[model samples]
Target: MAVNGRSRVPTRRDLAEEELMLDTYRGRRYCKQHPSQQMIPLGVADVCPLEHSAAGEQPVDQ
Candidate 1:
C-alpha cells in the first residue's frame, strides 16, 4: 500500500512468516503481533508500522 505517494515498507522476515501462517488458515488465524488490527488478507502486507521502528530500522514515510 502507498502512503502520501510513498512506497510501502518492505515486509520484515518475522512479519512475512506470521503473514504466511495467517494466510494458511485465512480467517481462522489471528495476528499474534497485532491482535487489534484487522485481519491482513492474502497479499495485503501493509500492517504494523511500529514493527520496523522497534527493530531499529528507519521509519518509512507514512
Candidate 2:
C-alpha cells in the first residue's frame, strides 16, 4: 500500500511487480520511464501477487 509519504527505496523486483498502482519498473509495459527516473513516485499493494489474480488462490493452496 502507498504510505502517505515515501519511506524506503524500491528495488528492481519491487518495481517490476505489475499489479500495484505505483509500479514503476522498467520492465513493465506502461512505465517506459527508467526506474531511477524520479519524476514519478511509486507504491505497492499490501496484498500478494497470487491474491490479486482472478485465478483465485495459489495452486499449492488446494
Candidate 3:
C-alpha cells in the first residue's frame, strides 16, 4: 500500500500499526483505525487540519 503524494513523517519509535481513513460526500476525513484484512484509505500520520484559524498559526505546507 502506497500513498501517492503523502509521505511518512519521521518519528522516534516505530509505529507498527496501520490506520484507515474515509471521506464523506463532502470530502471530510474519517479515521477507521482497524487491522482487518481489507482495503483501507489511509491518511497522513499528522492530525487533520482545522476548519478555521484560531490564533493565526502558520498554514500547513501541502
Over 1-62, each residue of candidate 3 has an lDDT whose tens digit, in order, gives: 33587777745343332221223332443322322223323454434333324544643333
Model 1 segments beyond 4 Å from truth? 1-11, 27-62
lDDT by residue for model 2 (1-62), tens:
35567577767777756436444444333222232223332454222222223453423231
Question: Largest lDDT belongs to which candidate?
Answer: 1
Using TM-score, give the best candidate's number. 1
What is the clash tally of candidate 3?
A: 0
Q: For candidate 1, lDDT tens digit of each residue in 1-62?
A: 56799977666985787778866865443445555545434565644432534554454333
How far residue 31's Cα lies from its native spot in candidate 1, in Å, is: 17
- The predictions' CA RMSDs to the true structure, in order, are 14.4, 14.5, 15.2
Residue 23 displacement in candidate 1 (angstroms):
0.4
- Model 3: residues >4 Å from true position, as ranges? 1-26, 34-62
- Decoy 1 TM-score against native: 0.25
Ranking of candidates on TM-score, top first: 1, 2, 3
Residue range with the least summed lDDT across 10 consecutive positions in model 2: 29-38
Candidate 1 CA-lDDT value: 0.55
TM-score of each: 0.25, 0.21, 0.14
Residue 21's lDDT within candidate 1 is 81
